[model samples]
Target: MTRYLYKELHLAASPISWWFLAGALMTLLPGYPILVGSFFICFGVFQSFQHARESNDVLYSVLLPVKKRDYVTAKYLYTVFMQMIGWVLCAVLTVLRMTALSGLMPYVGNALMNPSPLYLGFVLLIFTAFNVLFLGGFFRTAYKFGLPFLRFGIAALLLISIAEVLHHLPGLGFLNTTTGERLGLQFAILGGCALIYALCTLLSLRASQKRFEMLDL
Candidate 1:
């Protein structure tokens, strides 16, 4: 199981994966938002699945000695891992850009230095929501619809929009605040989101197993 999972991760982190990393840096260079990073990551994961299917590797994977549940689990883990890599790279790039711009113009850099806690919170929320929606929806839709790319893309756009709206709620407005005051609140929200993502990932894996079992091949 570990070996198979590593194999999946290796494939996900290959040179092709750099496209996602590059996209993250480009989209986030202007210090726009972290959601952009999540978008690119989700797209990459969806593309990986689509590529696997198109190359007939998915069918070959089924023939391996690995259990259906483990196979599904591996894919879910790979998706999360790849997404995190993209997110971290984006964060680093955002910081670097801010630092560079700040060096050139002190006021601009100073402004970027103190990101609103609300913005941080919103970015974290976007990251979490993307994982849950993309992982859950991607595998399930791929299994059911036989067109993982289109389904994942459509679902991702819808979920991103929903996440954006959620980030704007007045009651949840703490996500836009930057005071060191709400650090605990931010972590708490992130923890809750992480739990939700884990549950959704497990459910997705189970659904994938069931779907694979029912397939004619």
Candidate 2:
């Protein structure tokens, strides 16, 4: 499993990966909930598209004797890994920005420095859920249709629409609220998000297996 993960990480170190890292960095500068959410959504969708493209290559996995199951798992792991890195980057940038402002503007620094646990939980949950849905949908549809671009486009559109709806709904605006009351519900929401993510991943893997069996390669 580790070896398979390393293989995916190697691919992520390519020039294309730098572009994604840069994009993630840019999201931190905006400091707005919607902008940050959009960054994560786009990042996940792009990562899913990359995975689908590589998985469809007949010769790509020829040298590696890893099973299709492991291959898919590796992609999912890689997505999670990248998301973590992105979150850390954002945290570091935010902290630095706050620290810098503390020297000249005490009130601004104090407000930005004390981020609530609920805010952190909300960010993590949203990031995880977006990636799971985007990657799972892309892989399932790409496997079925054998058209990577089409699958990515459709999956991204659907995921983005759902995200937008969720953003506007009441009681779901955890990201904007930082009170202790909201923090108490964070764990429950995270658990539910995790459960849904797991189910989607399983469905995606099953779909991928069925499609792989039908392919001549």
- Candidate 2 per-residue lDDT, tens place, 1-217, comes to 6776577656532335445655445433333332244354445546544654665543475347867555556666666666666656655654554355324443342312133333334445555445445555545544442354345445545544454355347776653333446656755664565565457656655665565544455
Candidate 1 residue-wise lDDT, 79-126, digit = tens: 767766765665565455435543444334331222333333334455
User: Which candidate should be chosen as best, given TM-score against the real structure?
Assistant: 1
Native-referenced Cα lDDT, model 1: 0.55
Q: How many residue pairs clash (N, CA or C atoms closer than 3 angstroms) in each of the candidate models, in the order given?
A: 6, 0
The reply for model 2, stretches above 4 Å from the true place, is 11-13, 22-31, 34-58, 88-134, 137-175
- Colliding pairs, model 1: 116-178, 117-177, 117-178, 118-175, 118-176, 118-177
Error of 2 at 99 (Å): 11
What are the lDDT figures for the candidates, one per model? 0.55, 0.50
Candidate 2 lowest-lDDT run of ten: 109-118
